[model samples]
Target: MTDNIDIDRSLGFTIAARNARGRLVRLGPVLESIISAHAYPPAIEKLLAEALVLTALLGATLKDDSGQMTLQAQTEGGPIDLLVCDYRGGELRGYIKFDAERLAEMPVNPTLFALFGKGYLAITFDQVATGERYQGIVPLEGATLADAAESYFAQSEQIPSLIRIGVTRDEHGCVAGGLMLQHLAEGEEGRDRIHTRLDHPEWEHVAILGSTIKIEELAQRDLPLETIVWRLFNEETEVRLLGGASLTKGCRCDVVHIRDVLSKFPAEERANMADDTGKIGVDCAFCSRIFAIPVAELENAGETTK
Candidate 1:
């Protein structure tokens, strides 16, 4: 089945397309997930959705089964401290630092460099099961995430690709959704074929259809996936199915994990916390879940995972 199959729901949908060879995939979504860690306004909420969509789109291209992808944006700007999202199996969980003043200063035309003034953007891939990880540091370029990501791909993988990303608030004005489309590396013949299609009258026609996707419609309208595909592609265009997926928030936090982190802490800090309470208090970064581990429990559990 094509990965781009439509979803029928009262909320939103995601559709992905990968060619027969699976060298590339285009994924997009209308997300309404409200993570409990922090509250965000409409604009930043939209930005987070775009970031999440981008992560999953990139994740679909991974070649290793155990590998995971992370997208991190850190800036000195207030109201928007940072945005981080991890993608695996189309599932995601992310958090952003929010600042009202910084968000107010955001111009309509934002470049990655300007938005994240004097900051770094990183993409990390890890084989969690095997404990091997690789990270790439990217200098922010252009004004949008698309520009930085495209540059990263060209520099890191030496692949030529075109990426377009859009984020908007739907009509109801409650949620955020995003769409990403990319053309991957193919031989001259394949490239020529794509160019020919782009030049075709229908190419502009498709772009026009895509333009109809207002942020309002995406946020408020609960359109079926099939309807969305039809709206963009005529019946004559064969949209070969590749796969479909749903994204949910997740975090890695457990009592043992908390204890393991506490073990690495300076004994002085541990002793201080122990003095205040019977145990040490730890919080998970991603979820902000608090775990109070008494010194007695840590002693009984051993200093490490058993």
Candidate 2:
């Protein structure tokens, strides 16, 4: 990669900045590891990619020490019933629950609404220090994940927002990226009139700029952050780069963590969890990794907890 391309090892940028138009914008790239973790088809992969970028953008807005940001969807009867992804400390992981039999019958390229039918999208941020979590939920109204998120901000936060995410898969695998622009209320006067529209003209102008973004452009794997920013807002005054962060796929699931959770259960409960083969097997829904614990191991774990 050229010097212009710092080529973030994790494959994304992080920040919260205002452009010359006085709009807040955030850029983020989705890591391929998060997409390749599952052997999902291109269609599903596309949606997953979009969700990942949206997750990263929202994750970047979180406080430095916040626990994590989780983006989730619940589709009652569609092919995909559940979608959950979490981002924390510049790392993210997620999984999808879909009907294999039904999925085979789905179109090679299905629309988000078709894939999800009637459902709900939710974004949550966990505040570890205060043991409090803030969340926003919106119906799955639009045809894209970005719409769902934009709706969350508009309705829940009462902030007008625009978000765009793009996904591309080649022989090398998949790469996804996205950007978001939000209009913030200024000062005490602007804050009091939270409903008041500030810089409405600039908001529309920037929204037009945001709408012009092509999914392919956002999908650039080697494109420098500077180039993308300049290309989008070169017409406006000086655009600044507040800061950037990396995106990585990290799994916190482990044998010890699983064992510790199971240890809390009474011996009877633990026994019930064992298979006919007398092994307690657990599967991580996120990474889809399975772990089997012998009965002795479970007993020992329980003793330690006691």
Candidate 3:
């Protein structure tokens, strides 16, 4: 983990001249930990990796420290039925549910449409402090997950945006990196409402520069994110680097929590849940860990809660 200190972090930057802001995210061991939890196929592993990167990039934008951002892609008649990933603070977790037979029929490398025929990408933000929640949905009709995100901003938020994600795996493990750029011109109060003008010259100029980023540059572990940002916008007048946050593989599955949840069920139901050993096994899909709770303890669970 010490070697991955430089990786698994998200950095924020702003282009003053272009009136735009962007984020760079790179995942190494953190990504490997998440993918390794399950024996996912190559295609699923790659897709999950990309989703995690997208989650990190978007989740880092939360203003509240306790806020959470969740991204879900749901399909009806495709190989993958559901893809869910969420981020809170700097921690991220995600999983995929798919039909094995459908996935097996896919090619070595399946396209987004092939994996999820007619799906929708939904991004949700939950603010813990304010108890406020917001959601945006867009059709998943692009070649890449980044394209779906771009559509979300274009149709839902009406912000001219560009996103790129890259994932690569080898003998070692999987690593992913992503970039997000948005045009938010500075206004007297704060950011201006430039979404109405999608053809704005400033946004176009920045988008053109952002599109030059290659998959190799984004996924390369040796290439520093700062260098990538510099190479893209160095010619501009000012590129302000903001504070960054470290990310981790976040799967919050606690024995106590699981026990408490089980306690909510009637005593008869709890009894029925336990096996011959008198323990109920609870499995966490995120981390793929199982926790066994003794039924005897749960008998008094409701009393203790009161």
Candidate 4:
């Protein structure tokens, strides 16, 4: 648990012998930043933390570095209505929208169903380089977010996958971590392809090994990610580690950019947005920040641009 041991990063690895791949992510300050942006309750904080970790794990697998990965949970008849998180180029940001009164009525620790009564989880991948986007949606039916993610891979992608996420908060701050493993069976072209072999022996063995990871271990900041991977698959013949990626709190909110977009609106629309002080305020939910732009500025800018 050295102080300099890559606290906020994700490592990719493969067990060559088992035809499996995995990603391990640990968050320290990065999680703290995102959580601190809003004064979320303990339960909501923990849930958002898990979502961010899951986003990082899946985002790291993108073939293009410039691509983006977004995970959103939308529900009806639940305490939590919406939870959104996204990752792009090793940057992560997420927030949750929950009903305070409803959350207060739940038990000390509410179940997934209690928080999100009838929800669907959506995972979207956007490849900026090729302008291609793919998305998968699945009903949120599990005890934890990890279970829902595993369901997404199994149902939508038809891939054998395992995921574990953990979040712990104390007087110091918040820490979160996650691990995801997928069995990629060999194809006829000598490359990995999605195969419908949930009962395959190799996948079963690898999944069993992956399941041994406890939530406590995933949330342990002192334990190095590399050590965790080794402890799980040390018996494997070949475990190749890939390049690791660093993660940070990435809220893409720009005042200039936002203001410019506002300037494009019609003069009457801009006038209706102004407050008593003749300033229009734009709120960004992701970072919980407000941008104040003068109405005169937008009107003048709109006239010139139009």
lDDT string for model 1 (1-306, tens) is 223233211111222222111111222332444343546665566567667656766765565645789999887643467889887655566777766776678776455555577766789988777788888877766667767886776676544334444454433333333443333323435353434333433333434545565444343334444454555544333654344455555566788677876676665667777856677767666676678888766655554444
lDDT of 4 by residue, 1-306 (tens): 348365789999999778789999999989998889899988899899999999999999988989999999999889998999999999999999889999999988889999999999999999999999999999999999999999999888778899999899756589989999998766525533454374356888899999999988988878888889999999999899996888988999997798899888877888899999999999989889899999898777777875
Reference-based lDDT, residue 183, model 2:
69
RMSD of each: 6.6, 3.6, 2.0, 2.1
Deviation in Å, model 2, residue 238 alpha carbon: 2.5
TM-score of every model? 0.67, 0.86, 0.94, 0.95
Clashes of 3: 0
User: Using alpha carbons, what is the TM-score of model 1?
Assistant: 0.67
Candidate 3, residue 62: lDDT:
97
- For all candidates in order, the CA lDDT equals 0.56, 0.71, 0.90, 0.89
Candidate 3 ranges with C-alpha deviation above 4 Å = 1-5, 188-199, 300-306
> Ten-residue segment with the worst summed lDDT in candidate 4?
187-196
Instruction: Give the 10-residue window scoring lowest on summed lDDT in candidate 1.
Output: 16-25
The TM-score obtained by model 4 is 0.95
Give the lDDT of residue 215 in candidate 1.
43
* lDDT ranking from best candidate downward: 3, 4, 2, 1
- Per-residue C-alpha lDDT of model 3 across residues 1-306, encoded as one tens digit per residue: 225444898899998777789999999989999989998999999999999999999999999979999999999779898999999989999999888898999999999999999899999999999999999999998899999999998888767899999899756678889999998745624544643364357878899999999988888887788999999998999999997799998899998889889998998999899999999999999999889999989877777778
Q: How accurate is candidate 4 locally (lDDT)?
A: 0.89
